[model samples]
Target chain A: MERSIRSYSPKDTHKIGRRIGTKAQSGDVLLLVGDLGAGKTTLTQGILWGLGGTEYARSPTFVLVNEYPARLTLYHMDLYRLNSIEEIEDLGLDDYLYGNDLCVVEWADKAPGYFPVNHAVVQLEVIDDQTRRVTVSSETAHLDRLVMAIAGGADE
Target chain B: MSDQDIALAIDTSTRYAVVGVSRDGQSIAELSWRSDRNHSVELVPAIQRTLAQAHVSIEDITVIHIAIGPGAFSALRVGMSTAMAMATGRDIPIITIGTLEIEVHPYLDLGQDVTAIIGAGRTRLYIGTFKREDSLSNGHVYLEDRDKFLENLPVDSIFCGEAVAELRSELIGRLGPDYKIVSAPPPTRSASVMAEIGHAKLKSGDTTDLADIEPIYLRSSQVASAARRWPNTKTE
Candidate 1:
């Protein structure tokens, strides 16, 4: 995927998230990487909204994943709950990863696998109390267009 | 484009059958059920029964009218999707109608800006516009989360729909004459109406491909929709 970076405030993350969700179709996997409080879940919230999810999308920290069946079921997963790769399989990550629905995995780095390269990875950084810097990555060119669209284009 | 053809319309936006038959934009048979039960089990059977009652078969159906919801998300999905799949197999066209549009139909004493809304879990509403003259808007818009409703109403808006019964007084007190409270039929999919809309669009050459068709879920469940709710970022 083509690499792109964009800077946004935590508040702006949701709008970016919404854009992704709106365009997200069934069978799309989004891997999100960011430090704590970096707005990963906030962006995911926007994604859920874009994907036509009705229920609120929250951090799945306690639960590894929360499945919301909507126009397209949104599987919100937080890998932070998993201790290791061995535990990922038990959660049926693969079932949803390639399923006929959209999936967003927060803190995906904690699980470690093809997830890093096979899908779009949005890296968000907390630059200051009110600022966030994002670097979006992916191996597929399709994702580059998605990232560019989500990050708000050209300069971003 | 067949005359006197049968059509299957399904409305799962709320807890009702809102199903029926139509021939060239005319209602032949219409059936609805009132229960807070799962529409999943009931929608299909109701459709089949309606067809049987009308003495129509799948082959007789020229179109499928599915109520696209501003109601329960899951219910609308079930109804729309079921009809969508069936229509695809039969090679028929699928038409989508909004829940609020059905609610604010020609029967109500609505104002020009009638807010035909459906409850969106967590006190939010899905809205459709209407004219006091007894006709509804072409489509519906979401009120998003309720916390934002009062903050961003479309102005001169009157509230209607299943959500009105509970939230009426509060909304009226807040918005005033802008909020004309009116009794509306519980939201249901009107297959017959869908036929009218579909037939009109088809005649005007306004239909979309099945694969291109999707539910009009107002917000994205994806990160993108989240952006709409997120505080818009100020560019420096």
Candidate 2:
């Protein structure tokens, strides 16, 4: 199933991400594909907030990954600085991708094949200076319920 | 201490990292533990501790045996680089063995076809098939879906490796009672096995060049093709 939500501002994007994050489970992977300045970090910050994280989630483009403690541990990753698939493979992401935690990856398109079989992909497209389109797509039932919750505006 | 050649074996191919020291094909000291994705940090210390336990220093090491992986990429690199550095510093021979080979070595004596598996992220595995009679010729490793690999197992074949525990029920469901899944209760220390193999190879003057060794990372072509089958989610 797939769902698209339009964000009029960064706050709107964060709200949408919060909804998705609240419904995220252990071992859930959220792949974020978008150009720079497309509010990827904004969405992830909202996710961290929803997961009960106190600190802000920063872009992991340089350090590669950041771990945050919350209701469920969150592994935030970024592939923007990686130059090749070999580098990504060497990141040793299997443990985080398959472990008992939640992973949200920015610039995941850099190595699409490296992710697990079951995962949700969130694509952000810039519509204007103040608007963006966020699309979440996945075939698993977990993601289907997540899309439903987002579409229904179920904030609990 | 006797004046025998000492061999150091390191295997950080999976979550379990093992380091062992051997004197003429006999294990003197070995340490294996589950690393919390900190192989780079844990590996060198584990080696030092293992060598200390064996009452041997790094200079006494004459041969190094390392498991070149079809396993975790960074874990394999940690083991590989450490082995390479030690071998180069001592001007000793290094024997590179495949991870799957070490996994299946303990089970080869059963005289049955053995399949060695290493978990590759979610619901996928790195597997290699070994025929008992000609195990060396059939050690080609590849990646496959977990269910797919289990479904294709021949009757009465032995399945072994780190992945066996997680896939136990699936294997029983698919293959019934005819199959055997070997696990670590009677743990076959892989590093010890590597040391023995390295000893045999050293006796025959078979050693890998320090500059030429590389980890055997099986690519994810199968997963890539499966990803392509997903419905196009791109919007205009």
Q: Chain B vs. true chain B: TM-score for each candidate?
A: 0.76, 0.89
Candidate 1 chain B, run of 10 with poorest lDDT: B227-236
Quote model 1's TM-score.
0.54
Q: Candidate 2: list runs displaced more than 4 Å.
A: A62-67, A81-84, A110-112, A153-156, B1-3, B135-137, B186-188, B223-236
Candidate 1 lDDT, tens digit per residue, A1-156? 544445456557877777778777667788887788888888888787777777778789998889886678899898665664436644546446645678888876554443423478788877788677766667777566566656554224
Q: What is the TM-score of chain B in candidate 1?
A: 0.76
DockQ metric, candidate 2: 0.34
Question: Across residues A33-142, which tens digit of lDDT does each residue of candidate 2 receive?
Answer: 88789999999998888888888998898999999999889999997777666566667777688777999998777565668768898888999998898888998876
**Candidate 1: stretches off by over 4 Å:** A1-156, B34-37, B105-111, B130-140, B151-154, B177-179, B188-192, B220-236
RMSD of each: 14.7, 3.5
CAPRI class of candidate 2: acceptable
Q: Model 1, B1-236: lDDT tens per residue?
A: 54554567777776565788877777888787874446787777887888888888868888777776655656667887798788889897776666667665543443355666676543345767665564344444654545466566657655667777776667777877655576554543455656676566556656567777666655323323333333322122
Q: Determine which window of 10 residues in candidate 2 chain B has minimal summed lDDT.
A: B226-235
Top of the candidates by lDDT = 2
